[model samples]
Target: MKTLKIGLLGLGNVGTGTYEILAMNAAKISALTGCEIVISKVLVSNINKKRSLNLPADLLTENAADILSDPEIDIVVELIGGIHPAFDYMLTALQNKKHVVTANKAVIATLGDELMSAAAASNVLLKYEASVAGGIPILNALSTALAGNEFDEIVGIINGTTNYILTQMTDFGLNYDDVLKDAQAKGFAEADPSSDVEGEDVAYKLSILIQTAFGLKIPPLSIPREGITKVSKDDIAYASQFGYKIKLLATAKKNGSTLECHVQPALIPVSHPLASVSNEFNALFIKGNAVDDLMFYGKGAGSMPTGSAIVGDIIDIARKLDCLPCCLTPQISAPTKLIFAGEGKSMYYINFLVADVPGVLGKVSTIFGDHGISIESVMQRSKGKSEGEDVPVIYILHESSRQQLDPALAEISSYPFIKEVRSILRVEPLN
Candidate 1:
């Protein structure tokens, strides 16, 4: 049997899991690929760091150069979750003609085009099936299985931390802050949860998904991002009443040559497939001209789940070693005219705390009418005044563009009787 020596970078949760899975499942993996995959070397920050995996002493090292310079290592699997050394290490590995498999979405989203070019030139395989949705194989599905169809759009609840927080808020009536603390306590969120909570994590993942699904490459920062940090208990209650569940949705659609991408908290109808995905699990909704709409759901993040994806890539690469092509051909070019977020149109759920008086609704309705924004539905609830103040009112808009709605909001905000606008969330349709 052909033997494939592997070098691993980092020995954290994911790295240790990859090592354990490969070791425990060696016989099955060998049978599947007809190759013995061995972890020949590991690069870690501290060789003295207590690793959960009891790897051979010779295989562990503190120096990354030891692994990268070794010509015997056939494939390098990078599980280091960061931008700095991970980016430099992957680039160097590709330059050295070593095939690479990684689960770092931030690195892939930011430097994927350049890395793909490097791998292509070096005739080495660069696989990142675990970057977007953990264990779902969404990347392979988009690049291979669904390649025959013209994809209309991709809507995903791709970030697990945000999803977990949203699920808590919706299911248990907890606010964003409370759910976030719980997520951190449960190890679902990091100490510095800004990346996950502020939607940067989803934005990074969406960048890769957009590229794989539609051959689009847009900077993560370019996508408009709004996190669930501002989603209050009141918003969750109001959304539930409207037959909607609030989710952090990452969306990408082709607008002529422009591919529109954004990550934000959206109001999805409860019956939609994405709305029902609760907790740390994730679901992706893909709309294609031929396939119509399809959903892929699974664990979004974890040691074993991510390790499974990495192993799958390793097995596939080993099987295809000398038979077909060494590297995948670039399937699609970057779309030239990708649409910006503010240019897209959608229905909105606007909750305004307006005056309870009779003419107050009429004035607000006239302003919306003048702006050509329609109200699909309206709900007004009275919170008994603690200090004898005006009651609050909520309005849900039917459909409108930012161009039309922004002016309307500004006009409404300036009204004398309006106490406060509690929240405004975009409503994503099921069909």
Candidate 2:
């Protein structure tokens, strides 16, 4: 039987899981593919780091050059979650004419175009099925399964950490800090949870998805990003009162030749499919010209789930080698102009903590009207016992472009009667 040799880069949680699964299912994999897959080398940070699996000592090496330079290694699996050495290592492996697979979103989001070109040049497969949404197979669906159709929009809860925190906040009325602490303790969040909580992580994943779905390759920094760090219990309660749920959503839509991509905490209608994606799970709602609306849901992150995606790519590459003429080639096209926040039209939910005095609401309404933004609905809730202190007023505004509302919001912020403008969330139409 033929044998495919694998070189692993990192032995972190996801990498270890990949090695374990490959070992445990070796016989089954060999039976299906008519080939045996074996780990030929492992490049880790420390050779003395205690590993749970009893890997062959001869296969271990602290130097990445050892794996990249080896002639016997056919595939290089990079599980290192960073830009520096991981990016450099993958580039080297591709240059050496070795098939490459990685789970690093940072590398894929930033350098995917260059990597794809390198793989095509070297005539080797570059698979990153594990980058965006873990175990979801969204990339495969977009690139291969739905390649026949023109996709319109992709909306999803792609980040598990923010979803978990928001889920707890909405369900149990927990605060952000408390739930974030709990998430960290439960291993759902990292030591420094800025990337996940600040929406950078989701933005990175969305960049990859948007590239695959719309053939656009804008960096994460180019996309408008807003986090759940400022989201409060009051905001969640108000959304509930208005028949909506607050979810940190990554959305991309095509308009003519332009693509709009943004990641932020938005007010999704209670009836929307993504509104109910709670905890660490993820769901993607995709709209295509031929397929209409299709949903892909699964565990967004975890060692085993991500590992499964990597292994699936390995198996696919192995199988394709037999009949396919060349390695996987990504469809590269010119990037479409991104719809800036200043140009898009959408409705908004605005909450104001104002003094309980006459004409305060009228003053706020006049400011919005002067800017050509009309109010859809307004709800006033009494601050029970502290009636004379302040009151909460919530307004749902009609569909208006950011060009109009941004100036209006800025002017309203200076009003003395308006003690605070607590929250402003964009609302998407249901149906």
> How well does each candidate superpose onto the true structure, as a TM-score?
0.95, 0.96
For 1-431, candidate 1 gives per-residue lDDT tens digits of 88999999987877877888898899999999999999898988888877677767787888889878889998999998899899899989998989899999999899888888988888888899989899899988887788778787999999899899888888888878888888899999999999998999998998888777777677887888898888888888888898989999999876676666778898999999898899999999999888888999999889988888999889978877877563444334434445544337788888777665778888888999999998888777765565435665667787788889999989988988888877778888858
Candidate lDDT values, in order: 0.85, 0.87
Give stretches of model 2 more than 4 Å off.
327-343
The TM-score obtained by model 1 is 0.95
Number of backbone collisions per candidate: 4, 0
Error of 2 at 281 (Å): 0.4
lDDT of 2 by residue, 113-224 (tens): 8888898888888899899889899998898889877888889999999999999999999999999999999999999999999999998998899888777677887888
